[model samples]
Target chain A: MTDSITISIDGVEIPAETHHTILEAADKAGIYIPRLCAYPGLKPNGSCRVCTVLVNGRPQTACTTPVMKGMVIQNETPELKRLRSNLIEMLFVEGNHYCMFCEKSGNCELQGMAYRLGIKTPHFPYLEPKREIDATHPDVLIDHNRCIFCGRCIQASKTFDGKNVFQYIGRTRNKKVGVNADDGLGETDFAATDRAAQVCPVGAILKKRVGFKIPIGKRIYDRSPIGSEIEVQPKDAGSAQ
Target chain B: MANVATNGKRIVISPVTRVEGHGKVTILLDDDNKVTQARLHIVEFRGFERFVQGRPFWEIPVLVQRLCGICPVSHHLAAAKAMDRIVGGEKLTPTAEKIRRLMHYGQTLQSHALHFFHLVSPDLLFGFDADPEIRNVIGVARKFPELAVQGVMMRKYGQELIKATAGKKIHGTGAIPGGVNKNLSIEERDGFLKDLPQIVQWARSALKLAKEYTSEHLKELADFGTFESNHLCLVGPSGELDLYHGNLRAIDAGGKTIFDQVDYQNYIDYIAEEVKSWSYMKFPFIKSLGPENGWYRVGPLARINACTFIDTPEAEAARQEFKALTGGKPNAMTMAYHWARMIELLHAAEKIQTLLHDPDLQGTDLVVKGERRYETVGLVEAPRGTLFHHYEVNEHDQVTRCNLIVSTTNNNTPMNRAVEKVARDYLSGTTITEGLLNRVEVAIRAYDPCLSCATHAMGQMPLAVELRDRRGELLDRRAKGVDAR
Candidate 1:
């Protein structure tokens, strides 16, 4: 009778509204789903299926599917786990990570996800692809080698700043996120002060001047593993807070 | 690319170690087994200027610090100074200036500590002829455990000072255009006071060791990487040594001032960069002297040779002794670079103690807001030598052009020259011992060069983890969504 509906994710029940996606509801309930290319508060575009879950014996993206009353969702199935691990592996093999010497290793989400998943070594072979570094911009650096094509910078640039400084070039495997200018970042209107520079999930888009200011062991994820901040609570568990 | 001309066999020493990043020594040998030419090639390519174009000029102060891990604060403040002009100001708040100076001194201290204790000491203590595998900090620790500990502790203290003053140990984001974002707290200043005596004593002891090393190897040191070259530095109006801010000064091999207090913006009018066919790094020289004559040295030895006095008592005393030893003339002996580095370590410690007590250091006024300019140049004496950052901005504060000449590149010609001399003197076709080969590396390592800053890269990736049950059934998942955290 109430506007709020109950949904069963795995075996636990979570309360959510009709407009809420399974991801949004589960996040409020403190149950997590791994994701890439799904920035919070941005429009839910299922770009990376790291957030896949089973609904009624079928796989669905947790970021896109809306919650329905009495719906049963299995978020952690062996098959889904395998798919995510394989996807992470595919990404590793498709690019040159150079994790041994990367500046973003400790703070990198991709590297952290591998650790969280207990990936001893990438199941796939290393590709060691050579990528260009777009250092044309005076305040930002774009190392295409580290890019996973998440589109966070492109999305933030367009949605928040009303600036089309970044866009995707090419199609499918040939695709890459690029700046507006043809020559380099210097020719584009990419502002160093823009939110786009800070939204990079990897070391692809980085603000300059801060070179290893904080040593490796003292970094954010180094202090606490990623996702340790999210705590699941019942919808009505305001008393605990 | 043409496999180094002449009928000579190419001898390549890839990645001369004990320094940061990647570099190679290529010596072209003629049929007579004599060195024809030696090139210290910087292979890494980092196009920093090209990537910073679209970014707003103000953001560059924090961004360009990524250029080098060894002396990032130099780049941070240099960029901030360049932006200080864009913000249309010549003076920063007293507290901000003091804080920046403190950070610079700390950068110098930690860098010197790393170079002296961690990198060069091993070779000096154990001798270059020791087993190659064991000739490192590990070897130093095994040989002289107490001294090794002192070096590590001194470096750690300097790093903490950097963190307290700059807001982080390395690429601190505390500074902005026109001024800094924060001031050193009284407690923070007091924290360093407790360690002053120990740091000063350690600096003096290091200097003593350096003197001993120099005395023991007088004949070898005299011949090792010793040559005549012009020296460049930044000196105060009174001709005193100044690292944070100063006028450019160039001293010839005879210790005569070639140029005094020249405008940094017009560096191109005097200093010119030459690119060889083999290297990505350009050789910079005084434009008036031309490439052949202009190739000069900049760094500790050059700074010590060009300056009048240290201003601090202890370092000033050491300076006098060093002056007497070099005969009041420029010490072009590349081996003296270590001694000069030790002297600087003393000066940096002394400067930090003096700045810690300045009343204005804790003042609240840190920044000034103003109208923007189109172009400006920022200059600072980095731990290695002088660093220059130039920028041009459009109406919207977005960058239009950028040019950065780091300290190491300034010494490219000298480094190459040193390598050639060592290769010619020590290396031969019939008896190419590892020790002889190491001397070539030792020549390059003398500069404590940081090549990673000269080259650059970009990176990306994603993360996800799914927990499962038996029979491939789902249970739960923990994910740091690419954007979630």
Candidate 2:
């Protein structure tokens, strides 16, 4: 007989593997747990802390935590939601992320997560960090004020290109991403084709020279999340039926 | 001890550890100190260049950006430049140039920070004998929290700038052959200006820390110095220092200018490739002489040495301090690599400030729309060294030919020589420990070479390294899969 582990997510029973974390099992069973800096092709960085879920009453990142048997996961608990909203608030204020002027206005992961969590206004005051637009190279650009330090670009540089181009520099609140010796992109060994640019989930490490080619409502990857089979359901689905 | 004739034998290192991409290094050594043959191999293969043959010129930037994760900006820029040249388009508005320079500066900042902090710092800060398990930036974080924090902040600032200027961080559709799609708002510019003072302060502090560290570890750095080779870089029209756009020039270790105005098309004339049977990557040497005699180095150390003077006052001051430390023009001292990096950081910050303060930055005329036609080459000095992207397009704007000479390629000979020196110094006298080999690898990593971008879209194959006995029997083998990780 095959071994199976039972788990409960929001009072719903589900079968899971023995090695799975409560969060993983819940996610596998179609439970929604918000996240940033979590990509399928990369290691879990857990920097955003947006995917926090309550497991046996403690908050945990769903991306890194593995599944365990007989585990209980609470994805949309009141506390968890509040924590997620607060995290979103921190991201909005930590950088000058004015969505109206942002190139990633409708398509940004940060913006999407905040909207999904009902973040109408940033509770914290804007920590307007003065940043530079380094478009020295014809291709890549870096804007410090919008970066959330997810380390995705760094990971991409290290893993994808085998080039350690993008890196996290500085400490909390002052932390930023930059090239070797903080040079301009045009001056780095970084190629115009490096995947480091793709690793950035936000607008922090953007393509140089190229902006706003596709008009609003014409960009790709703009459809509903449901189209991908990873459906987003209402908060209280069980009671609706 | 008997002298064994190990001639005609091959030694291959697959999945060259401590390198950015899937590549191998093969060496053929004789009984004497002479290296009979050496080749840097690129094992992973994909037909990316071929695949791009028929794609729309406008789409080439996006497609080429996927060539390497670390240097997407280079490819994106090159592709855009090529397309612009082909279409015979008008120049980008002054505002666009400023914004583009700003974004490029961000990339340089983040990329260099990654190299100095995450990839090579382990070898510098901790003794080379430190366990590989703990010999990483993570370890640095635990030990030297302040430095690690500085690195993180520096990298974040650059990336954030990229995001704010472009739409997305990666594969952003910001620049086209004609021009940029969006213009920067006053609020965004003002917001960025406000944070400049803190960033400048942070850079200064980081520079101080680096200087102190280098002084404290002078002996360690001196011991780490490897082979000496000629330097080549790009300089502005007035023979002033230039990294973004300039003419190519070569300068020997004796401070003599060797070649000037080396055209991009004639690169093959000055640079020759040597292929080894064991390794897939080819070693490129200066064609001024033959492969056996020619050797060249590029990147930060090479660029700083090649330039006569820096433009910015802050960078000039840093350069003066660097010269004071080296007691002359810094030549092959590997420790100068750190000094060169600091100087570049200062220059990048100062340059960014200058670009931001330009009155024309707030203008709306950024992009100049046009169609595609002729062939063109885009060249720049990446932080690591000189980079060239040459493209030829037909009437339909389809790429007919695409030739790229990346910064890593420019440093090929020096890299091999550095490896040989490290192997001889560290491995010859001591026992063959993985740490010793890793140290040799670390010397190469100091350049922060990117092999994936050098041979992009060639194939999807694993990089393998094999250690062989005198008779070519495999002693040890290591391989990494072909995923874009």
Candidate 3:
């Protein structure tokens, strides 16, 4: 068996594997790191920049940058908080994200992250772009105006279904996600049977025909995060990799 | 064409590049012009069908939505539709149905837009040899800034609409089996309506530009030679073109309906899927026939030809324009696929506007709540073509069997045939050129097949497949390359 390495996160010394990142080690030790584009199943994109943490006095995305031996990582530094707050603010203003009317209100990752970071008022001005609602299919809707282009859906489409259905169309601020060539989801060779939809971290791509099946109180994830519902024994609590 | 004999050996194109999903092409030719064997192999498998076997039936839509990012809504709807069938539920409320149509239109608009502008446009507008470095939409942004911006804006509008209407964008939780999960607020409806005219204008201008480009390069596109094959798509009850909800129809090369008005539930009876040892992708064909004899095509080109008329005025006009260019109803010419896509875009925009104006959209009850019955199936036309999701559940409402047939699978037979024909035409007579191969690949990409959704669950890294000869020779290999372009 390989020997474990020790690292201090927020003053707690935790045993970690040699290849573990500061975020991974800290997460293993019951530390929470806010993230959006860092799903366990998909490759870490680190585009959201919400999981930034102080590693050796510098801020970096915990999902991408790996850990070093004897590293002093600060997940809750003032600088880190300000950076995270700024990132969240940018995300809010970059798209037409009105959370109050959103069905994913209490359960949304973006809203939850914002609340955790204590974003009382959006520092940036609202950028309400002229957007269209594609509700052609009986099950899903796609709203590009509110998209952050985190590429989670794209990754999900490509990685899981082996379909390169969702692709990054443009670049930089002009960047957006769409079905290849702006085809309706119905026209793409995508099946309703693949599992890519469950992994989307935002509300950019949605079910079309069945938008409000259950009341707010009966939502599956309304009471707890997906992680919270699954029990974690001490032996099975480490990195899922 | 090259007369090289196979000697009973297989000629394989591993990791068939540029097409959607992971697959390969294998061919076995006898000494004569008669082809002995051809297989379009789906090389990667993640067992998505098997994985969903024991999960809760209500979670089928959510789980299956993760199957393909491009067409999650199709899967979501298909799963929901299937569940609705099982539960013996009434149809969704008028408002909910309208909202559903609007969302479906959004996905169609954005997805078709992406196919034309991003995936296939680069090859057409820039020329195949323009520059590998500048072959993507990003390069188009630099070369033709206005068009690129329009494309981005159009895509953003579709995706944004999806997020707003569905609550979450990619894997939205809005759609349940009986109906939708949320209603469009008056403000939201107004917001969507305000943007309709601009989108319509943008779509029209884009279509004009695309036509101009096509006319300029007519020689190259025409010289590509149109292939003849059967076309399959869905048609609405009013004899108008439809994608979301419709019965299946297969039309022959001569523009005659071969198989008309088939029910979605009887899909398995008409269509059959055959798996090849060389590839993981399965070739779906007309049942009771051999691979070579059962070829069929779907998606924009196929859908346009399969339908008699489009409902929306702008789309109908666009369709006329497409017919003018193709010298008949657009059938097998891949170039016309772009035009067909634009027509769908116009229709999508118009449909969205129409839905937004409906007064019932402001109603509170988006869902028709009920208990679920055991087995169900959902059917919808994805951008690429027909999509179906069937689920069987136990008494506890857990899925016992989940079978999915996606659009790519529908096109598998025709796509493999197209690749072989292109390969023989472009590679046989002369030395193989990268440009020619690229064009061949572009021809396949025009359909925008989604193998991933047909094969696995979301988030698994695509495993590259390579093929070697009997002597252990490397014929072709696809490395895990980055999407740098």
Candidate 4:
């Protein structure tokens, strides 16, 4: 007999592994709770709360929270949906999400989530924060204006490439992505093939000498909306339909 | 950024139509109801200069190219040329130079096709007063299906050339600091050559159509936004028409060469940029003449006017007839820009065939690697006009300081002057008509300014055409989007 526990997500009773988190169980059950900073290989940072759900009558980051037996987890409630969408909107206003000007427009996970949430415009005013570009690397460019602080590059670099080419420096308000080198990206061995370079969900870190290689309308997310594949629909999911 | 001397009534055309990026047209009227100053304001602030500070020198070409989607290749090449100087290889390998030249011609063909057929063709074809609804590409297809299809096909071939040379059509990242990333594949080269006949025919037909249309409307075509002013452009070593790259030249309104063969890196020695408080766009003027007298024009008309000859056969033939339009002297008429654009398109096509026949373009050695250097200046003639990308990097090869003199910024003063002239001719009183607004936009559009590439700041009011009174009260505001017409 398989060791499993019955967990009630929204109204459906589903079987899950003993130690699986709500997000992992939900994924196994073909559900997408809209996540960032929680890639499959990396340790969950739970910084971007796009996957916040109601667990035992309280809000928790689904990536970190374990699935409890008979916990009555609410994955797709109206209140949870609003909370997740508001978080996405906040992320947009906080950074420079110039979708029309951005190279990562259609393929962007953040943009995809916005489309999935039916967000044509953010509720909050654009921050338009001044950011710098690090073009010191020979084969890549880091546009800080579009960084969303997902820590994917940090995790991916350390986990996948066995390097710490990127790291989050400073605290709230004065924080930014810092390169490993003291002078700049030029002093680092950051190749275009690095996993850290490829992990950017936005246009923040882009491979040099390959922009617009894909025409405008023929990109990854251009043909269809984001998150349609491998996304098992929750019968009670809110507003996605 | 010119100051308006007028006092009372004001007409503001915010978010001007049929141009790349956000811009504003403001006409200040005096107490006598005559025009005082009309200024074109470039609102968006990309701040590529500030943001590119910490990046490595090699990344300049790719990053700076993002400044404009329509003319990324120009930025890409300019940055590469600057980097070339830093490497002490300002002159690249023969093969590399030929490939770069070919890529530039591709850019010219695509950009001119887009500008002529997509942006301003309707006004030239159906009159400036054509319905706003049909003043776009869709309308072009509806009115002249063959011309519209040709335009699309021209753009397609141009895009195919870009894709074959670099990687993609819109913002291909082919040109690097030293040279290109790769040589043209056999398939890509053969495919482009196969369509040579069709491309040449279209260029010829475009010249004919533009000539007929321009001659028929000679009255308005000559008088519309036409002015005698100093012109500036890049010319070949022997004064043949050079678009991709060349030393800068200046000519006075009377068609006499004022300055010739001045290298671009030394532009600051002869050229000076003046900052205005009212606008983010800086006015670039000749250092000797000062701001008021030094303001000059650049672009297709200015290039055709300033150049002594066109190297290509078909374009040269077209150029002769165009030069005859003004008794062999440089024609200052702004409407003639379309004709000059077509002529250049023919030249570019001819140049394309020459480049394709050259075996040098197929050489295996592309980028020439060398020790990194501190600073370099790159200059290229964008389809709109001249563009400069200057950068100073640290010992670690990180860019520390930067300066960019884009073509639109170079035209800011003349563009404002053109607006003022049009406002004086069109605006009668405080009441502004749709025709007046359209004409003002038409005058500004003659420069074909790309505000997105020129300026980068984002959050601004959506373009509005507002009529304000003496007391600073908004009198009338138009609708937004397609209904703005």
Q: Is the docking of candidate 3 incorrect, acceptable, medium or high quality?
A: incorrect
Sorted into a CAPRI-style docking class, model 1 comes out as incorrect
Instruction: For each candidate, give the TM-score of chain B.
Output: 0.90, 0.87, 0.88, 0.93
TM-score per prediction, in order, is 0.74, 0.63, 0.65, 0.72
Per-residue lDDT of model 3, residues B320-425, tens digit only: 7777665665457666677677778888888888778888877776656466466666788788888877778776445789778788877777766666665555
User: lDDT (0-100) at residue B462 of candidate 2?
Assistant: 36
For candidate 4, lDDT tens digit of each residue in B29-110? 6557666676677766779899778765666777778787888889888988998776666667788788889888988998
> Which is superior by DockQ, 3 or 4?
4
Every candidate's DockQ is 0.05, 0.07, 0.11, 0.11
Fnat of every candidate, listed in order:
0.00, 0.16, 0.24, 0.11
| Candidate 1 per-residue lDDT over residues B177-212, each given as its tens digit | 778767777898888999898998999999989978
Candidate order by TM-score, decreasing, is 1, 4, 3, 2
1 or 3, which is superior by DockQ?
A: 3
Predicted complex 4: CAPRI docking category: incorrect
What value does the lDDT take at residue A78 in candidate 4? 81
User: What CAPRI grade goes to candidate 2?
Assistant: incorrect
Lowest lDDT 10-residue stretch of candidate 2 chain B: B1-10
Cα lDDT tens digits for candidate 1, A1-241: 4379999988998888888888878877877777767776567677777789998878888888988899899987788888888888887887767564355667788887777676768878787765776766777778788898878888888887789888889886677887888887769888889878877777788776343444445666777665554443435322111
lDDT of each: 0.77, 0.66, 0.68, 0.78
Runs of candidate 3 exceeding 4 Å displacement: A1-241, B1-40, B223-225, B288-291, B324-330, B369-373, B428-432, B457-485
Query: Which prediction has the highest DockQ against the true structure?
Result: 4
TM-score of chain A considered alone, across all candidate predictions = 0.91, 0.85, 0.86, 0.90
